[model samples]
Target: MTLQQRVNELVRACFAGIWIESHEHTDAIAELAGMCRDEQWRLVTWDIERGLRGPSGSPSEHDAGDPLAAVRAISSLADGETPAIVVLQNFHRFMQSAEIVQALAHAIHDGKQRRGFVVVLSPVVQLPVELEKLFVTVEHALPDRQQLLEVAAGIATEDDEMPEDAQLDAVLDAAAGLTRYEAEGAFSLSLVRDGVLAPSTIWELKTQAVQKSGLLSIHRGAETFDSLGGLDALKAFTRRAMMNRRSDGQAVRPRGVMLLSPPGCGKSEFCKCLGNEVGRPVLTLDVGSLMGSLVGQSEERTRQALQTVDAMAPCVLMIDEVEKAFAGSASGGVNDSGVSSRMMGTFLTWLNDHASDVFVVCTANDVQRLPPEFSRAERFDGVFFVDLPGREQKDAIWALYRQRYDIDLSETCPADDQWTGAEIKSCCRLAALLDVPLTQAATNVVPVAVTSAESIDRLRQWADGRCLSADTPGFFRKEVNSGKRRRRVTTKPSVN
Candidate 1:
């Protein structure tokens, strides 16, 4: 339901205080004002600059611009019949004051008996401890597809400026998580720059929008499944599983995968490419940035970040090195005072319950750090093990990076032993940078198989027969080496 509808019912039920978490206050206030006018109710809005604006738009004399006086004046606008609404815009800025808290407490208590309601509107929901129980939090959602198309139509007025029906889906999809204001600006910018409204400008603006929260970072690169060399099984599964387009109203639950691999594997690269492969945006969830210095702030940020992920639906959510991200959760949070534990709980709940069509891709080098419960079924469709590239896979990876680095195919590539896609790319990059052959450059590139040998061995042993293979179609099976003797000497006669 819209914020206005929700607030209308809550106000009729005598909810004295309502906290609206909204980024677009102008639109929200306009909707609220129209609702109040239609219902023939008394409405007044207050802010630090305008103080209180009544039906006449005149500044109230109750200490014009004084927050405390404006809050206290809500009682004066109350009556026995028609309900009165007092909107405090950006009231969270003044919530730090104890006196204002006391005044608001008094006002809310009196508002119930007098048919007056206090609505706090802010970009964030930061309810103070004193008013937490009194206020009901409501989220103002981002513009939907239909609303975005309407905004697009308003901007691209010319006949040829607007995209056609089939192409307009991409434009609306690009503006999915944007505000109406942002959408208008994007549409106008696209029209002015390209002489046509397009999704390019909207996606460019969306990257900036997603980065502002310091939680989710969006990747809209040109990478696709063609960019990666291996992981055919993984690519096929995700391509077939992700519901990029829906058929009916029945909601499809989210299906995620847990990827376990040693460092330098194609896990991260696969995630970045999966979005473009499936016609969706790739959102990287940064867990470290979610931490906050104040109490409960970290958990709140976690909730907000997940909410954002939900809002940007039909997208890929990539959480890289997730085992280390929530390590404290498995350790019982003795490190960060259980903040990681709470964050983990919130994430696990969302992973199981979120109704949005977000394909979660979590990559981890070391899965042992994660809690045992995290591997439970129903949370993810499968746990895939991305092993080091085999001979044929390495050839493909080498060919990919060779073309990327402008290396000639005439010169035979050097021998690569247990090197990952990343190491191959690094080798090619170093060869190109140093003007050396692949053989000499390969000397400088030590594989993760060699560096983290023990850890890799343990991981390989753990994932063997227990996880699905990224290269194959089913559960991964460890291959027995059984090295062949080059040329056996005739020393069998001397066997003692």
Candidate 2:
């Protein structure tokens, strides 16, 4: 619902205390003013700088620049027949004052009888214990597509500056989560930088915004599915899922996929590539950075990060090495005083329930360390096991990397049995860096299959018949090699 409709109903119902969380105060106040004018209700606005201004366009006697006085003055505007609204601008800053808190509590109780409402408008809602139950918090939503298009059109007035319908739609998509002011700024900046408006400038501003937040980072790269080889099954599944459209022509969003594999298996690279393949921005969420030093801060940061993810819809959220992120969640409050557990719970709930068009890709080298509930159905579309590249896949990876590093295809490639895509790339990089033969460069590279042999075996065993194969359809199975035929060889060895 729009802010006007919500405030209209609440004031009519005599809800005395209303808290509006909004980043764009000018737009919110303008909306409230229009609503009040239409409903024939008296509207008064207050702020520390401007004091209290009544509907008559004059400062009231109670305009003392004091929040306590502002609360006490609400009763004077109360009337049984007509509703009155008092808007407190940035009043959360004064919530720490005892006098202001007590006065607000009493005014809210008395305003119910007189049909008066107190609306607190701030960027954030910080309610004191006394007024918590009395106030109803409402979020001022970001601009929708229509609003963003209007904003773009308003800024791009010139004939050549305005984008066509298709380009305009793209621009709107880029401006999805931006506030009204931010959208205006982005559109204006885009026009100033480029002769016409484009998504590039908006995305640049968005990346800077995410970086400033410190909770989420935006991945902007040219990497596409063609850059990586293998994982055809995984790529096809995600593409089909992301491309599926509803009757309304909106794409059906896939929940996500849980990728389990050993190190250097292309899990992270695939995630980054998938975003570009699907035409969505990839958001890299670092769970470790979400951890805060203060109590309850970690949980708050988790919520904020999820909110940001939801805001930036039609994007991919990549949580790399998720097992380490939630390492201590299974233990019951033993380590880190339950911070990890609470943060994990918050993330799990969001992952399961979020309706945003975000495709989540969580890569984990060790699924055994993750909670079992995390892999349950509905949390993700499927749990995929990415094993070492097979012969064909390895050859394809080598061909790509050899071209990338200017290695001669005629030069016999080193033996790459059980080598992963990452290992192949590393070998190519080392060969180029040292100006040595591929075989000589192989000495500097150690494949994870050999370094973590026991762990890899255990992972393959656990994933057998349990997870989907990233390379082919159906459940993954570890190929068991029966002992080579040794009937005649054993006798020959004994004779020798």
Candidate 3:
């Protein structure tokens, strides 16, 4: 529901305390003012800078800048028939004081009888224990596509400055998560730099916004599907799934895919390339980075990070080495005091229920360590197994790396059985850096298939019938060698 509708319902129900979590205070106040005006109710606004002011441009009778007095004065503006709403801007700043807390608690309790309401408007919800039960928290949503279009149009008044259709859609997508003020600034800045409304400047400013949160980092690179070799099946599946739209022309976004593979496979590279292939920005989410030192902080950070990911929709969210990120989720709090478990729960819920256009690509070297619930049907569109590169795949990988590192393609390649794409790249890099032949560089590299032989074998065995093949269609099947051996006969003695 819109902010005005929610607030109107709560006010009509005589909910004494309403907490609005919003970063755009001015926009929120303007909305509240409109709602009050429509309902013919009295509206008063309070802030540290403005003290307390009514619609008539008059100050309240209470002492200036005193939160306790503000709370007590809320009842004076209301009558038995008419309702009054006193908006407390940044009131969370004063929620720490015992006096303010007690006064708020009393005001909320007495407000219902007098048809008076105390609305706390702040960017974050920091209600004290005393008033926690009394206040109902609501989020003021970030502007949607239509609203953002209006914002862009408002700034770009000139005929040539405005974009239309697809170009306009791109601009709105870039401005999706920004608040009203930020969007206005971004639109204005776009006009200043590009002489027209475009996505470049908005994206530049968006990078700064993401950096400030310290939760998500934007992945900017020129890596595309052509840069990587193999994974044709995986690539085709993702492209088709992501491009599928509803009958109404809306995108029917795929949930995501869980990539299970040994080290050196192209899981991480494929994820990055997928973003470029689909024309979406890749957002790298570091789950370890979201863990906070204080209690409840980790969960809050997880929620915020996920929310940010949702805001940056029509994008890819890549979580590398996801197994290590939620290592102790299944330990039942025996390790790390249940922080990992709670965070995992929040993530799992979102994975299953989120309706955003984000395509989550989680790469894990060891799926054995991941919780079973993580790979369930609805959590991801598919669970794909990226085994060691086959002969054809290895040949393509070798050719690509050869060109990339300026290696001589005519030279003989070393024996690369069980080698992955990464190992091949490493061989080429080492050959170029050391000015050695590919065969010589091979001696310095030990493929993960050999280093982690037992683990890789176990993984292949588990995925044999369970996971989809990253290279080919249908379920993955481990190739088994027949036991027949070839025998050599001596011709001279006819020993055979």
Candidate 4:
């Protein structure tokens, strides 16, 4: 059901209190107020500073200008008639207090016969156990593509321009994941930056728009499918899965993908390429950045972040190096004071039940450190193991890096499968810096498969049959018994 219909029905059913969680409070509040106006219900708002505001027969605007008084005023309007809606702003701060709890409980039961309901609006959601059952919570989503397109069209009309509809659609796609206010600001900025109000200008302004949110950032990555050396199977799988164009029949859900591999194995690069391949804008989520200092702030940040992702439906959401973000928190609760547990719970729940069209691509290096519940099949569509690149894959990677930097790979290629794609790229970069051949660069580099042999073997052991291999068996062989090859020791020390 739509937010409007849901709110109307809930109000009709006499839902005592309705709590809304949203980042775009202004938009949500305006929408709900419009709905109330349509239903002809008297709308009132409250703050701690305000006593009681709205149409209570007296029709006095009680402390609307004062934050605290506004909450108090709205809270005091439980006995009013004429079908009233009391919107209490930031009242969650006092939800834990005994007085506020009792007041809200009494107001809920007392307003039953009378057409009155209290609405709590906040950027964060915090409910004491006493009011959890009493209040019905609804999420207020950020502006979606359709809404953003409307905003852009409105802006263009205001500016008196008759741009092509395709250009407008491209602009809307670029502005995805942003709220209404953010989209408007971005559109204005894009118009001014390009000096022509062209669709290309939207990219420049989009960078600025995403920077302000500290949530998911839209990436205009230059990397394409051609940049990737191997993993043809993985690439093909994602290409079909990420298609947003609906087929004749109901399109299958794009089950999320999990990339499991060691660091510097090009997992992150694959994610970015997937977005580019799918022809959709990519949003990168920095999980560590969401951690907050204040109480309940982390959950609030997560909620906002996920809401932003959902608002940009039919897009790819990449969470890089997620194992560190959700590492081993289920047992031994002494670390970080249970913050990890709560974060894990929030993330897992979202991953499991999220019905939005956002396709998640989570990359993790160490499976042992990850929570067991996260690896289950239901959480993600497929879990692919990104083992060390084999000889042929390494050759392709070497050729790719050489071409990228305009270097010759015929005589300078690293012949072995010891290095990962990232390591190979690093070697090529170092070779260019030193004005030397690629083999010389290879001589100075030791891959993780060499330096951390045991850990790499363990990772291989765990992924042997449990995960999909990035390379074929002809090039990269797994030992029959141990599931890993013996590490090669050399006399010369290698570069990082």
lDDT of 3 at 40: 95
Residues 1-496 of candidate 3 have per-residue lDDT tens digits of 9999999999998899999988898899899999989999989999887788987657866655777778878877778678989999999888878988988888888899988899999877777778879999998988877888888889999999999889988898888778789999999999999999889899899888887888888876889989888888899999899887788888666899999999989998998899889989999888878988867889988988888788779899999999999989866656899999999999999998998889999999888888888899889999998988887889999999999999988989999977889989999999999999999999999989788999998998898788888888777777676576422111111235
Relative to the true structure, how large is the alpha-carbon lDDT of every model? 0.87, 0.86, 0.87, 0.73
| Per-residue lDDT of candidate 4, residues 1-496 (tens digit) | 5577878888888886899876666677677778877877777766555445553423355545544434344445545465678777777877766876877776777666666687888877788878888889987766776787688777766454525577666766677666688778777776666543465666666666666878667776878878888877577767777664575756877868888877788888888887778777788998887889976777678877787777666688899888788664756335777777787888888889988877888888788888788879888877887777756677788788788788964664666666788888888899889988877877888888778888878877787667655543212234453456553111211245
Model 4 segments beyond 4 Å from truth? 46-80, 92-109, 128-133, 158-166, 191-199, 244-250, 330-338, 408-411, 414-417, 473-496
Give the lDDT of residue 174 in candidate 3.
86
1-496: candidate 2 lDDT, tens digit per residue: 9999988888877789999988788899899989888888888989888888876558966665778878888998787668888999999999989888988888899899988789999976678778889999888888778888788888999999978877877787788777889888888899889978899999888788778879888887999989889998899999889887888877656899999999998999998899889889999998988988866778877887888788889899999999999999978558799988888899999998998989999999888889899999999998999988887789889999999999998988888877889989999999999999999999888888888999999998898888888888767877677595211100111233
Which has the greatest TM-score? 1
Q: Residue-pair clashes per candidate, as listed?
A: 0, 0, 0, 18
**TM-scores for all candidates?**
0.93, 0.90, 0.92, 0.83
Quote the lDDT for 241 in model 2.
92
Judging by lDDT, tell me the better candidate of 1 and 4: 1
Worst 10 residues of 1 by lDDT: 485-494
Off by over 4 Å in 2: 55-58, 79-81, 245-251, 293-296, 334-338, 484-496
